[model samples]
Target chain A: MWDKRSDMIVHEQDPFNAEPTPQVLAESDITPVDAFYSRNHGPIPAITADDWRLDVSGRVERPHVFNLDEIRQRFTTHAVTATLQCAGNRRAGLIDVRPIPGEDPWGSGAVSTAEWRGARLADILDAVGAEDDPDLHVAFTGPDVSEVATPPQPYGSSIDIAKARSGEVLLAWGMNCQPLPRIHGGPVRIVVPGYIGARSVKWVTAITVIDAPTDNYFQASAYRILAPDADPGAAGPGDGISLSTLPLNCDVLTHSDGDRVPAGPVTVGGYAQPGNGRRIERVDVSTDGGTTWNQAELDLPYGPWAWCRWTHTLCARPGPLSLVIRAFDDTATTQPETPAAVWNPKGYLNNSWPRMTLHVT
Target chain B: MWDKRSDMIVHEQDPFNAEPTPQVLAESDITPVDAFYSRNHGPIPAITADDWRLDVSGRVERPHVFNLDEIRQRFTTHAVTATLQCAGNRRAGLIDVRPIPGEDPWGSGAVSTAEWRGARLADILDAVGAEDDPDLHVAFTGPDVSEVATPPQPYGSSIDIAKARSGEVLLAWGMNCQPLPRIHGGPVRIVVPGYIGARSVKWVTAITVIDAPTDNYFQASAYRILAPDADPGAAGPGDGISLSTLPLNCDVLTHSDGDRVPAGPVTVGGYAQPGNGRRIERVDVSTDGGTTWNQAELDLPYGPWAWCRWTHTLCARPGPLSLVIRAFDDTATTQPETPAAVWNPKGYLNNSWPRMTLHVT
Candidate 1:
C-alpha cells in the first residue's frame, strides 16, 4: 500500500528499524514469530480481517463496534508468555555530542518473547461499557494513516483507568502460537505485555475512552522523556511525559566471560525485568566486582509483567578481570551504582549497573 | 562461497535464527556500520584482498609475512570508537526455561559501535620479536577453519606478554570509518579494541609466539564459561571458563517515561563498558529501585576499551515505576545485587543490576 510512485525505500536495513541480526537459538523455548522484531511505524498497514473494526469510541457508555468475529466471540481467550521491550530498545547507546534526531538505531533487537493469544482488555473494557471515569484515558487507535502534515504521531498510546481495568490488558489475537502478522499487530493487536512496544497498539483502530488525557499526536507529540535539563526543541504541547506503564527497570542485555571451564567451572547467564508492577527478585553475580557475591539462577516464573532469567557461577584463575551483576525486586528494589549519576536528555530510562570485562588465560 | 551444487535449504526463516529485532537509532551518536548488528559464526567468508597475508610466527626471530600493504605501510595507524559486545548480547534475556546451549540467541543485537582502524599488535609485537619467556603465550591464528576436530590443541587465544605489550592491540583496517567488511574481518582484522570479540580475531591468519596456550577449537573447545554448577549437556573440555577480556558489564538497554516533557521531566540513556583493563567510572540512575540514586550522565573519555554513553533525569509522576542503573570502575568496582548471587553454566559473565520499567503517564 505504499506505492506513491515507487520510491518505497524502507531499507534502513529494516529489522523493523534497529538492532537485531544475532541469531543462534535453534529450538530453545519458542521465539519464532517470523523472528519477531518488527518495531513498525509505517508500512504494514494492508489490513483485512473482514475489514477489521474495533471502534469502541470516546467516553464509552456502550459505544461499541467489535467485528473480527465480534471481537473473537465476545471475549474470553487469554494467553501470555510475555517479553516485549522496546522503548527504543538500545537506541544505539545514545551519546549524541551533536547529531541526535530519532528513529530506530536499536542495537538490542528491540526485545521479543511471544505466546500472546487474545481478548481481555479487561474483557474489552467490559464489552465497551466502561466509563466510571476516574479521569478516564484509554486511547489506542491504529489502522495507520498520515502522509505528513505532521504525521509521526498517529501511532498513539495512553493507559490509565487502573491500567485499563488491569486484567492484564490484551486484545491480541495470537503470536508465537500464530496468527498476527500484518507486520505484527495483525487481525487484532494490543498486548501490552510488560509494556513498551509503543503501548502495544498495532492496527488497533480506535478505543478512545479518554475524558481528559489524550491530546493526541502520540499523546501530545511523541513518546517523551525530557528534563535532565529539558529542551527537546524547546519542549511544547502539554510539554512531555506519556510513556505508559513501565518502571522497575533491569537491563544487562548480554555480558560474557565464559569459555574457559577449567578454572573449575563457571556460569553466568542474564536477562531480568521489572517495569510494570515490578517482579525479578534476585540475581547477584560478581566475579570480583562486588568483592564477593553470587546467587543467580532464577528462570521460570514470569508475569508481574514478564522478563526474568538469571544465572551465576564462579571459581577463578586466569588473567584480567571484572564481572558484575545485580538485581532485586519484589519491591526491595536495587540496581544502580553508576553511570555517573544517571545522565539524561531523552535517552530516557537508562538502568545502569551490570558490567563484564574478562580475559581469563 | 556456498554452492556445492547449491541446494541451500537451511531456511528456518533465516534472519539467521531470528526474533528480537529492535533497530531504531537514526543517530544519537555513531552506530552506523550498515546499522551494525551481526554475530556470525560461519557463512560470510569470502576473502580476497589480493589474497591476504599476515603470518608473524612463534617465539619470533622474524617469521614475518605482512602483506595488506605490509601490514598497512609498516604499522602506526590507530583509531578507536570501540564497543563491540556479543557474549550473546542479552541471550534472550537468559531464557527462563529450556533455552541455553551454545550461542546466538542474542536479543541485544550483540552490541555494536565502530571506528576502529589498525596497526599495533604492540607495533607488530615490536616488529616480530618478543618471547624472552615472560610466560610466553601471545597466539592468534585465524583463516577460520574447524567444523570440529583438530584437537591436539591448536586453535588459539593467549595474551600475557605483558598484555601483548600493551599498545592497545589493533591491526583493524577501519570500520565505522569504512573498509573491512567481509561480513566484518575483511581483508584485515583484529582490533581487540577492548578485547572479547572473540579476542578480535577475524580472518587474521597467524601471530603465534606461544610457549603455552593454544588448545584451539577456539582455545580448547569453544570460548568457554561453564560450571555455575556445570551440566550444559554434561559439560566437557575440563568444564568451562575461557573468554579473553570484557567484564565489568552494565546494560539497561532502554526504558521510557517521556513524552515531550512535563511531570517533572525524565530522561534515561544506556551503554557502558569496562572489560580488559577496566574503566567506566560511574553511572547510577534509579527511578526508585535502589530506593533513590541518581548520577547518570557520562559520555566520552572512554578507553579501557570504549563504550560509555549514559544519561539520566527524573521527576515524572503518574504511577507504576522501576528503573535502575549501576556502573562503576576506576576501581570503585560495583554491580552485584542479584541473579542468585551469580549462577553458572557456561552462561558466562552476566553483569547484573540494570533493571528498567516505567509507566508514568
Candidate 2:
C-alpha cells in the first residue's frame, strides 16, 4: 500500500490490487496518483530510474539495452491524457449473475485517467529499426514474477505492431508531471492508450518485437473471453478471444446499489469510456429497466482517449428504484443489455448496462 | 439501369440507385461488379479516363492536378479487399420502427466487398506535401451535381486527415481486377475502406485538405444522426453527429421477413461488418425474441476490412417462428436490441437486431 490511498476498496492484499471509491474517481478530471486504481498480477518490484533498463530485441535490426536516462534524452518527450480500465473493471456485475469463484469482484471504480509523459513508442521503434510489418507484435515483459501465472513466469503482454507504431503508445517514466509510482508502472511502462490496462504492461524490463502475440500466460491464456461453460483450467493457449481494447462502458457514480435516499428528484452522474480510439458520442439512462431511455448531457473535458463524464436529472417516487446506464461510441455501438449476454468463465469485460438498485424513502 | 443488372432492387430511377438480391450477394466472396450496390444522389456522370483530372489543393505546400494515367503510373499500386457499406444499409429496420420520410428503405444489400486497386491516398498526400495536422480534414468532390442540395451542388464528403494518411484510403481505377465501372466511380474514385460508403466519394474530381470538415450538404447536413425530435428541414450544417465509419451490424441473408420454411433443421446465414478497424468476433442467433441465444460460426475469408459471413442452424416446430440476429465485435460491443433505440430522421445506421419472421410449414 505504498502508493495506494487508505480509501481504496482493497480486493487483494499480497499482490496489492485495489480500486478507488466512486467519489474519488469522480472528484477530478485526472485521478490523483494515490487514488488511481492499482491492478497487478504480482508483487510490486522496486527499481530506481538509474538501475532500470529496457531491453529491445526480437524482429529488430539490432538488439539494444537502454537505461532510463538514455530513453529520456534520446527521444522527444510527449504526453497523452488517457484513461486505462482494468479488463475486470466491472466484474461485480457478472458475479451477481453467477458465481465466478477465485476472482476479484471489482466495482465500477477500476478505471482512472492520468496525464502520462514519456517517449513515443513509435519513435523508439524507429530508432531500434523495428520491422514495419503489421503482422508483428510488440511484447513487453516486466520483472515482477506472478504466482498466478501458470509455471509462475513474469507478467507479460503484447500489442500489435500497428498499434505500437500508431504514435500513441508510450514508454513512460512520469505520471501527472510526477515520477511514476511503484504501485502503478514504475520507472518505465508501456502506456497503450485506448487498450485494456493489461496491455499497458507495468514495471517494464523488456520490449520484444515478435511475429505473433506473446505466449505469456497473461496474454495467451488469461484476459480472454471464453464460453461461460468452458473450464478455464483446461483451456489451452489461444483458446478464446484475447481481449485488447476496452469495450464501450459506462458506470453510475452518484449512487451506489442499495443506497437509501429521500424520494424526490435524483441526479445521476457517471463516466463513459470507449475502446479503440472511438469517442463517446452519447450516454443514456433508463430508470425502468431499459424499456425507455433518456439521453444524458455528455462532457469530454479530457482528451479523446479519456472518459466522457455524463449526468442526468430525473424525478423519483418512493419505492425500490432501479437505474440502468449505457453508452454509445462514435460508431454508435452500444453495450450488451444483460451480463448473461456477455458473461465468460474469466469474469472479464462486464460491459452490460450497470443496473443499480436503490431504496428510496 | 445502365450499370445495374436486371436482378437489382432498384430504389430510385433518376439517380440510378439499387442493390443486388441476397442470393447474388452471397454467391461469391468478392461481389461481382454488376451485383454490387449503387447509392447515388445524382445522375451518374460519363467521363472517359482521358477527360478526367483530379485537382489536389488546400493546406498543402503546393496545389497539383493529375490525370488518370499520371496517377496510375506515379504511385505504387495497392489493392485492398474492402467492404463498402452505405450509412443507410439497413434503413428498412428503422422504417419499421417509425416512418422516416424521404429516405430509401434499403434492405441489407447496400454493402458489398470487392478488390479495390489504386494508388494509395497517403502517397498522393505525401506527394502534394500535405500538412500533417490531425485536426484537419481531407475532402473529396465529384462531378455529378445533385438537385437534392439546397442550391444544387456536386456530391461531396470527407474523411479525417489521419484516416487519409493511414494508407488505406485509395484512388481507385480498378475494382475486382477489372477497369472500374462507370456507375461505381469509373475513371477514378476514392475507396475509403472500413468507412461509410459515402466517404468513398464516387467520380472524385477534387481533393482538398482543410482545417475542418467540408460544409458540403452531404458531409455537414446529410448523413448525420439527429435527435428523434429534430427536423432535418430546419437543421443547419453541423447539426448532429456526422457519421463516418460503419457501425457493428449483421443481416440475415438466407431468409427474408415472412418466409415459409420446413419444420426442422433450418440453416440461417448472414454477414456481419464492424466499424473503425474492429473485427466481428461473435454473432448470435435467437429463435425466440432474444430471451435465449446461440452462437453462430463466423468466417472472414475476405480480408480484415471485409464482412464476416456467419451461419447458425436451429430446429423449429410447426408454426410461426421469429429469428433475431445480433453481432459482437472484437471489443465485445453489441448492437442495440431495437431499431427504436437508434432511430434518426435520416434513417441511417439501423444496427439493431434484425428480426425475421417465418412460417414453418
Candidate 3:
C-alpha cells in the first residue's frame, strides 16, 4: 500500500471528508491515496478482498457474481491518470455568500489526481450480456450512507447507458500502483472520469440497467441545485438542476492567504482542471482586481481527466493586495470574475476566478 | 417586549444569528422590528434600561458615564430608515466554491431594514468632548460578545475618526416607536448607516479614540477581508482589507425558487440596495442568459440606508429557465457576472447577478 499522508484538511470526521493540503497535492502529478481527498457519504465497509463480490444482475441476459480474482481474469486492465473532485469541493465558497444552516464548509483540498487501473465498465456490461434499451441508465449501489441526508440512506448514483458505452467508466481496484485503500473504495470502485466524484460510486457492489436514474437519496434529492429556501423533502428526482459534468476550476497551492512577501518578484503556482474532457487553454493572473492580467506558463496535461499545473512570477507592490487567478478551458469557457456572479443555492459548482488577498510588506 | 416573527432564518443558538425571510423583508417599505434579523455575537447580558450606563472611556476631555435617559436628554432625536446587513451575508455562495472547513454558509437573508431613531454619534462625542489627531480611529466596544471567537471576546469595531464625525453615525435607542428590544441592543446601539452591520456595534458600552483601529478580536481579525485561506489568528488590525462601505446588492424576493406557475406572463419584483450612498441607476432582467435584458421599474428610496424595491413582468415559455437580474449603481459599477470572480475566504459582500432557475411546468 502506498503510504497515505495524514496532513491534509479534515472538514468532517464522520463519512470521512478530507482534502489534501495544496502543497502536497501540487508537488506531484499523481496524488497518493493518503493525500487524495476522500468524499465519503457513509462509513467505509470492512469488506475483505476475498469476500468482496460484484453482483451484475439487473436487465442482463447472463447475470454473474464476479469476485476480485474473477474480475481481473475476465477483463483486461487499463490505466489512466484522472483527477477526482467532490461536487461540493469548492462549496465553501458558495456558503461564504450565504450561510447554509447544516452543511460542511469545504476547502480547496477536496480534489486529487491519481493513476487508476481498472477494468472498463463497458467490458463488464458486455460480458454480462446487457439487454437495456437506449436512452436508459446504469445504476450503481454501495453500502455507504451519507449522514447528510435527512433519514440517512444508503449510497447510490447513476450514469447514462450511452456514457457506459463510452469506454471511459471503469471498475477500478488500483490507485497509484497500489491496491485501492479501504478509504478509497478498495477491493473495487467505479471510476467515472470527467464527472463529479459522486457519480463514481465507491465500494460499488451492484449495477442495474434501468429506464431512468437511481431513486437513491443522493441521486434523487441531494445533488440537484435547490432554492436557498427550498425544502429537501418537497423535491424529487429530475425536479431541479442536476449536476453532471465538473466545472472549470483552478487552485493556487504555492501561496496561502495573508502571506507576507518582499515588495519585489515572487513566483505563484497552482493546478488547473477543466470539465468533461476539455483541456485547459490558458491561465491569467491579475494583481489589480482584474483590471490587468499576465499569462502564466502552463504544463501540458498528462491525461484528459488529470489537472494541468501552471506557474508565474510577478513584481509585488508594498500594500494590501489580492492576487487573482482565472483559467479558460478548451471549450472557450472562462472562470467567472466574481463568486457573487454565479451565486447559487446548495453551494454547488463554483469555478469563479479564485482570489487570495495578502500583504506585500 | 416586541413580538419577533417566527418565519425568519435562525443560524445559531445561544448567541443568536438570524435573518429575515426574503419575502417578508421585501413586503413593506419599512421592515417591522419583529421581522428584523438579530445577529448576536455573545450571550445577551442581563441589564435594565434604568441601570444601564454607557462608559465614555478613552482619550476624552469630558469623560461622562451617562444613563439611558440622561444620554437621551442631552441630544436631539432623529429617525432614518436604514438596512443593516451582516458582512457575511451571502457567504453560502462562497462556501459553495470550496468548503471553508470551519465557517458558516450564510444565506442572503442575513440582512434587515428598520427605522432607527436615536441621537447622533457626533452629538454624544460633542458632549463627551474630543481629543483626536489625524489618521486616527474611533473604536466602539459593546457588551455583546461574538461567539465565533474561541474565548468569546466582546464585540468591538472601529471607523475612521472622520467617519465618526460624519453626523450620519447614530447612537440609536428606539426602533419603530418602541425602545430597542433586548435582542437588538435594547438600551442603545450605534447605527453606522451604509456601512457593514459589523461597524454598527450593538449594546455599545465604550468608545476609544486611537491612532489605529481597535485591537479587539472582532475589530482586528473578524471583519477584514483576508485571503480565503488566511489564518484568523495571524492577522492584526490594518493587516488586511478593511470594509467600510457596503457593496451594491440586489435580491429577488417576490417569486420564490421552485415556484410552480402556468407558462405565461408573470411579474417579478424585489429590492435593490446600492453601495455606500449610491442609488440604483438601473435594474436589468434577463430570461435567456442575459442575451436580451429588459429594464424594470424602480421606486425612489426613502432614505440612504433603506432598500429601493423594483418590479418587472415578463412572459415565460414552458421549460427549465434561469431568471437573471443585475443592478448598476450610480457610479457605473454593474454587478459582476459571477461570484467566483470576487470570491474571498471570508465570504463577504457578494453583489453578483442573481439567477433563479425554475421550471414552468
Candidate 4:
C-alpha cells in the first residue's frame, strides 16, 4: 500500500530532477524563489525541533553543547542575502561532451539567493576560546551520513584556519525572517556566506578544531573539483582540488534558438557572483563571439554573498544569432572564453563563458 | 544527530506556500523546476519495491490481488507526459479579499509535468472483470494513516463510473522512463492524466468499485473548490462540496506596476492549461487591456493532460501599457474577466484573464 507519508502532491514534471536548460533570467533583479534552481544530494529531511541540538567540541577551551533556544539567545544575530551556487552548478553543459561520474547532474538550479541570519562562526570561535594554531582546520559535521564499503570517514568538510577565523562566517539560525525549516537546515546550521554550500553544513551536529584537514569522505573524496586538464576517467585523486571557496569568475548563458519572439527588440538577463570577496566590476555581452562586446546594465550593487543581476537589450535582426555573456570581478578575473578549454573530468567549477544560439526574428 | 537521509536533495519549492511577490514567471512559458512550486502535506516516504502491491476488488465480477510483479506482468504498458496542476496552485492571489481556512497558502509552484506509464485502469478493471453496473464509482486507497486527533480515514479518492470506464485512467508504474521512485509512489500508482493529481493516488494498495461515491476524507471534504458566491470558511464535512472534476479555465496574472519598454519591440509570455479533457483552442494577448488583442504562438500540441507554453511579441510604443492574455478551449469557455467576480471562499478555481502592467519607452 502507498504510505500516507508518500501521498505527495504531484506536479507536471519531476521539478527537482530536470536538467537545467539555458533560459534567459527574468527581467527583475531579484530572482523569485521558485525560479531559483535547487542543488541537493538526497530527500529533504523531516526534522523535529524537540530532538535538535548543536555540539561544540574539539580544540576549544570550553567544550559546550547548546540547544536551539540557547544558541538563539546567547549570540548576536545578523542577516545577509547571498547566492549559494554549487561548485558543480552547471555540470550538465560539460557532460554534453562526455559523461561525468558523480551525484547530481545539475543544470543551473544549484544556484539560489536567500536571506540568512545567525551568529558569526568567528564570534562563536572567540566565545569558545579558540587558540591561534596554524595547523588547525575548523571542521564542521552534519547529522547526515552515507555508508562506505571501506569504513569511509563521516560525510563532512572543513574550512582553512584563516577563513574560519575571519569572523565573517556565520552559524545561521534563520532565513527570510523565519526560523530555518528542517528542509533548509533547521534550528542551527553554518553559513559561510561567500563560500560554496558544501562547507555550509546543514543539520550541524558538531564543530571540531583539528590539527589537520578533515579526513571525512566528503572532505577527501567528494566535493573536489578536478583540474581543467585532468583525464576524464582516470582516478587517483591525483592533484584534484577541494572547493573551499566560490570561483572568482561568473558565467551566464541564454538560449533562444527554438523560442519564438517577434523580430525588433529583445532583452536578456541573468545573475553573476564571484568568489573570495571579489565583486563583479562589469558584465559584457557579445552577439557574436568575443570579437565584439557591449556593456550590460548592472541591476543591483554587489553584496557580500549575493549575486548581481545583469541585463542587456538587443535590437532584433532576422537571423541566427549567437549570444555570449561574461563577467569580470574587481580582481580582473574574467570567465574563460569557452567550456571546451576548461572541461574537466568531474565537471566542477565550469566558469566558462556560456554560448547561446538564438534566432532573432 | 541528523539522519543520513537528511541529505536527500530538495529539488523544488513548495509553490502554494508563498505568493508571486517579485514576479518569477517570465514570458509565461517554461516554469523553472526549482520555482515550479509544490504542495505536499507530509514528508516524503521511504518505500521499497519488494514490499509493494496493487489490489483490485469490490463490485468486480472476479476480484483479484496483484503484487508488484504480477501487476507488471499482467498489463500492457503505455506512457503519457501531462501537466498536473493543484487546484490551489494560485491561491495566494486571492487571500487578500477572503481567506480560506486550513488550506495551504500556496503561491504558484503547484504545477509540473512528467512522462507517466502503466497499465490502463480500464484494462485492469476489464481483467478483473467489470460488472454491468453504470452507477458505480471506482475508489482507490493508499497506505498512509493520519496522525491528527481526528481519526484518519484511509487515504482514498474516487472517479465517476463513466471516467473509470472511459479507458483513459492508468495504474502508473513508471515516470519519465524510470521506475517510479519511492518518494513518488514507486512500485505502482495511478495516473488520471487529465484530472487533478490528487485523484492520481500514489502507493496505491486497493481499488474498489462501489455503488455510491467514496466516503474517504479526501473525496468527501478535501479537494473541493467552492463556488465564488459561497461563504468564506464554510468548507466543513457538512457544508463542503465534493471535489470531482476540475473546471476548464486558465488564470495568468502579472505583478509589476506599469513599466514601459523601448518603442522598438517587446515580448509577451505566460502559461495555459485546460482543466480537464478541454483542449486550448487559441491564446490571445492584448497590449491595450481588453481593447485590442493579438493571437499568441502555442508551443506544443495539447495532450490529454498537459499545459501548453504560449508567447506573443508586441510592437513597442510609448504609453502606459497593460498586457492581458486569454485562452479559449475546445468548448469555447473563456477565463473570467476579473478575480473579484470569480473569487471563492475555498479558493478552488480562479481562472481569470491574466493582466500585466507595462510601459513602452
**Candidate number with greatest DockQ:** 2
Model 2 per-residue lDDT tens digits across residues A1-361:
3866788899998888899888788778899999999898898899988899999999999789999999999999999999999999989888888878889999989899999999999998999899878799999999999999998999999999989998789999999999998878888898999888999999899999999999999999999887656788898898878889888888988778898988888888989988777788878787887656778998855788888999898888899989988787776666777776677778998887788898989
Model 3 interface DockQ: 0.06
Predicted candidate 3 versus true structure: per-residue lDDT over A72-158, tens digit per residue: 998999987888888777777777776655567777778888888999999999999998588778999997776766577779899
Every candidate's chain B TM-score: 0.34, 0.97, 0.94, 0.83
List candidate 4 stretches off by more than 4 Å.
Answer: A1-37, A147-154, A227-239, A251-257, B1-361
TM-score of 1: 0.34
How well is each residue in B198-274 modelled by candidate 3, as lDDT tens digits? Answer: 89988888887777888777767777665444565666655446677676788787776677767888788888888
In model 2, which regions exceed 4 Å deviation?
A1-6, A46-56, A59-79, A117-134, A165-167, A263-265, A286-295, A315-322, A357-361, B46-53, B59-78, B117-119, B122-135, B176-179, B286-295, B314-322
lDDT of 1 by residue, B1-361 (tens): 2211122112122222222222232134456655555544434456788788878887888888888888888777888667777665555545432356655455544666777888878888878777566788787876655443333332345565766777777778777677777656787877666656766777777888888767666655565655344566654553355566665667655553322333557666777776565577667776656645666888874455667878777777876667767676543334554443333454444566656566666
lDDT of 2 by residue, B1-361 (tens): 3556788999998887899887678677789998899999999999999999999999999799999888988999999999999999989888887888898999989999999999999999999999977899999999999999877899999999989998789999999999999989898999998888999999899999999999999998988887666787898898778888888888888888888999999988989887768888878787877756778998854777888998898888899999988887776666777776677788998888888798999
DockQ of 4: 0.01
Query: Can you list each candidate's DockQ?
Result: 0.03, 0.37, 0.06, 0.01
Off by over 4 Å in 3: A1-4, A232-234, B1-361
Q: Which DockQ-derived CAPRI band holds candidate 1? A: incorrect
For model 2 chain B, give the 10-residue run with minimal summed lDDT: B332-341
User: What are the lDDT figures for the candidates, one per model?
Assistant: 0.61, 0.87, 0.77, 0.63
TM-score of each: 0.34, 0.90, 0.53, 0.46
Clashing pairs in 2: none
